[model samples]
Target: MTEKNVLIKSWADPITGACPVAEILRTLGGKHGPRILHCLTEGELHFLELTRAIDGISRKVLTDQLKEFEEQGLILRSPKNDARQRVGYSLTAKGDALCGVFGQLYDWSQYYR
Candidate 1:
């Protein structure tokens, strides 16, 4: 197989193990997963900034999502050195890698659309 074919086939079905696409889809399957990640891609942002950037997302949902992402090792939540003691969210290396996948999917989406 050519390199491109091998790459595509690997995502479709691994040669000797189970494909991880299902798990990836599950992690990304949500109203705000992509949006939240996209926002963080720009740099670390506080909770309020994420809320404002992702239109129509409620506080409760945003909180839940951020919690989930932190648990999954996709985001890092830390106390920022500021007067208000604000918390900031930023993507981990794994999260940044996943963002590339999202970008590929986005390009594929345009082809289909």
Candidate 2:
């Protein structure tokens, strides 16, 4: 089928194309992203704080997840004014918009337990 046809078929209710947020969800649904978002939900946090808050996450994984989230415009990273070595991450408007969806997912998971 043509690309357009495939997309149309994918969007149909039964087999609707991948979830609307598939791209972002696939990347952000990782263990690290939820933890990162939970940390930032309170306030901006530096890399060190995130690592500590998300115990067991490797430095490399944290770095990679942050980079992906930033690139996707889901989060903002700012350099600390007093410390050039310090950077903090916070969710953006787009990221905040997903809060409801995340909450629903969390609630649904409880049903399966």
Tell me the alpha-carbon RMSD of every candidate: 4.1, 6.1
* TM-scores of all candidate predictions against the true structure: 0.80, 0.75
| Per-residue lDDT of candidate 1, residues 52-83 (tens digit) | 99999999989988998999899999998889
Error of 2 at 22 (Å): 2.5
TM-score of 1: 0.80
Each model's total of backbone clashes: 0, 1
Backbone collision tally, model 2: 1
Any runs in candidate 1 off by more than 4 Å, and if so which? 1-19
lDDT for 76 (candidate 2): 98
Best by TM-score: 1
lDDT of 2 by residue, 1-113 (tens): 68788665353235755565566668876877877876787778899989888889999999999999889887899988874579989989877766556778889999887
